[model samples]
Target: MSELCHQAGDARGMEDLMVDYYVDRPFFDELVGLFHERTLAETRAALEGGVEWIFANCYYNSLSAGWSPAIFREVFVPHLRAQVELVHRYGARLDYYDDGKLDASMELIADCGVDVLETCTPPPVGDLDLRRAKARIGAQTTLKGYVDLLWVVKHGTPELVERTVAEAMEIAKPGGGFIIGSSDCFREGTPPENMHSYFQACLNYGVYD
Candidate 1:
């Protein structure tokens, strides 16, 4: 994907080309803001009808938008803030999903007023360490993440799953602002036993008394 981006950027060399266009703060901000105004109308109305949560499948759009925290803030945050405010106005919550290197941007994202942040992956898969991110964003933002789905779940031992979930809970399940989850989607080939261990560990170790 990165190589394709480079090739397209080099060939087109246009201002609105995918590379520069995605990173262009002003252009995307206005574009997304205006776009959401029309699109969120029905969705916001649905929330008014007694929805509990509004899931902004942002990672859902990350494929086309090509994510970066910088782009997220400049282009997406303003609109995300608006959406969150809208949801809250209707007494609903907004769950923001973005699977990326979020260590630098989680704080900025927290400022956008999302109730929950999805897919907060820890390194060496992503740069986020929930222990640290909890301090930064978890004071207000509820952290929801499935930890290291591929390496730590799909290919891991039951003991590894237990140990890993325990470590994550110890760091994040404090002051009541954490939700255990896979940092990314559980792929098709994942072991069922490991998946069971994950949910079981969350129930066992994710308690806050």
Candidate 2:
């Protein structure tokens, strides 16, 4: 693992400095970086680290409601591709953590040779029809995480959680490549009851037999 020193300042300056520091380092096996002004530098560090893969986190909501693929291509894709290529040189993969409807970015993600994409939200927010996504991306690339954080385990009843998990298993387990996980990172406010219920649901439904 490579450590990235994130200093306090404008994003652009920090990214530039980070890139300068890691462009020729020899200690890390993987490097994770942020997008924005520092994306390019982060990409360079991945190259220096001899990283097998890089992970990126992206989110789209009310604050970024207008986010688009065009914007991603212009501001993020160039560096993302570079980092991915560096990892590929070492026979590695690039995984992105995007927890939103990515209808706009799917094609670009495919073009970048990203090996795994995680946290795909369901309808009302995302366009991931699991069957369709697998068809589009093919067997080479993997899709991870489809559990609903807000509904299946947060506000829903135990019966609802169990049913939802059962459905997910029925749909996603048919394929050998899917991974089950929460839609996003766990939040502190998530009720313990809900958490226990969700896991129990998974335990009861996730078995392949």
Candidate 3:
């Protein structure tokens, strides 16, 4: 969908349409409605199966999707709130995942009652400043994933992995809401030694007294 939107060269206009359901209100209604319908059904099914976590991976990264604050507040926040409510009603948590810049949407994500927000990708690949994210929304939502999976994890040395993990832990570990994880998946060709270093560093720095 993102690819199609970008290919159409109207991503921002797409966001604007979401702002008002502009071009076709009924179409937009059905589209957003479909999302809620399917999402709620799956949430119910997962909870009934006794799962404790509902990882809702919305790949429409707000930054890349051309989301403005209006798009978030007016378009996405309500649906996310509904998602959180349904999940919490069943004694489950919603871990929302979006794989692009998250700096601007962190507060709104937390405000929508999401329990966990993953892949809070930091700069170069993403724009999240972990220290600020920790300060702002850390009290409300669990801050997950800041390591650069492609660079520091897959391509870089074990020493770099350990250093990255250590730096992340130093900032996000203090208050206990952070999870040391990758910005995205460890892709194919990721070094096994790097994986080892990642966990070793986790144990080394992520241990809480």
Candidate 4:
């Protein structure tokens, strides 16, 4: 779809339409409705199977090649709203994997009624702030992930890793909405001692009152 837009020389139009939905509303609507139906049905099945969380994966925008916030709100929010409603209908918490820079879209996501957010990165490497995000979402949503996988977990010493855990807790833990962990997986070559350090740190410092 994007390549087709590139061929047509209409960047703004492509993003705003978000799929040719503007030009071919009927087909787009039909396909989108089909997806919604299947997703909702599967979600219902999961609920019946005793799952408490309905997870989804969406990596639409990033700090590098992101669309306007307006475009996302107009083009994407409708579908997300419907999915969120479905999850809530089944009494399951809704959260999606957002593996890109979400500093700009966090507010919009919260508006779509997500119960929890995962893989939230921190700045200087990625673009997020734990304390600020906590303040922004308040009790409306839960924020998870933050400890750096590469710099701190893989490369940095165990002490640095411990400090990272302590700091993440200090900032976002006080309010009861943070889950401290790596931004993603600890790489294949990540030191075994580092892995030990991470779990131990979590146990030693992550106690809740």
- By TM-score, the best candidate is 3
From the highest lDDT down, the ranking of the candidates is 3, 1, 4, 2
Collision pairs in model 2? none
TM-score for each model: 0.81, 0.69, 0.86, 0.80
Judge candidate 1 against the unseen true structure and give its global Cα lDDT, from 0 to 1: 0.72
Prediction-by-prediction clash tally: 4, 0, 0, 0
lDDT of 4 at 201: 94
Error of 3 at 107 (Å): 0.5
lDDT of 2 by residue, 1-209 (tens): 11122321132343343353357322111222333235546655766777666776544311133434664565356655675676677776777777787656765766777787777677655666766766666465667777777776677677777777777777777756666677887677778877887888778877666
lDDT of each: 0.72, 0.61, 0.80, 0.71
The number of residue pairs in model 1 that clash at the backbone is 4
Order of quality (TM-score): 3, 1, 4, 2
Best by lDDT: 3
- Badly placed stretches (over 4 Å) of model 3 are 1-21
**Model 3: per-residue lDDT, tens digit, 1-209?**
22212321243345654554666777665666665666677778889999998887665637556767776677677877887898899988889887788888889889989899989898888889999999999999998889999989998999999999999999999979998889987899999999999989989988878
lDDT string for model 1 (121-192, tens) is: 777776787778888877888999858998899998888999999988888876888888887888998899
Give the deviation of candidate 3 from the true structure as CA RMSD. Answer: 4.2
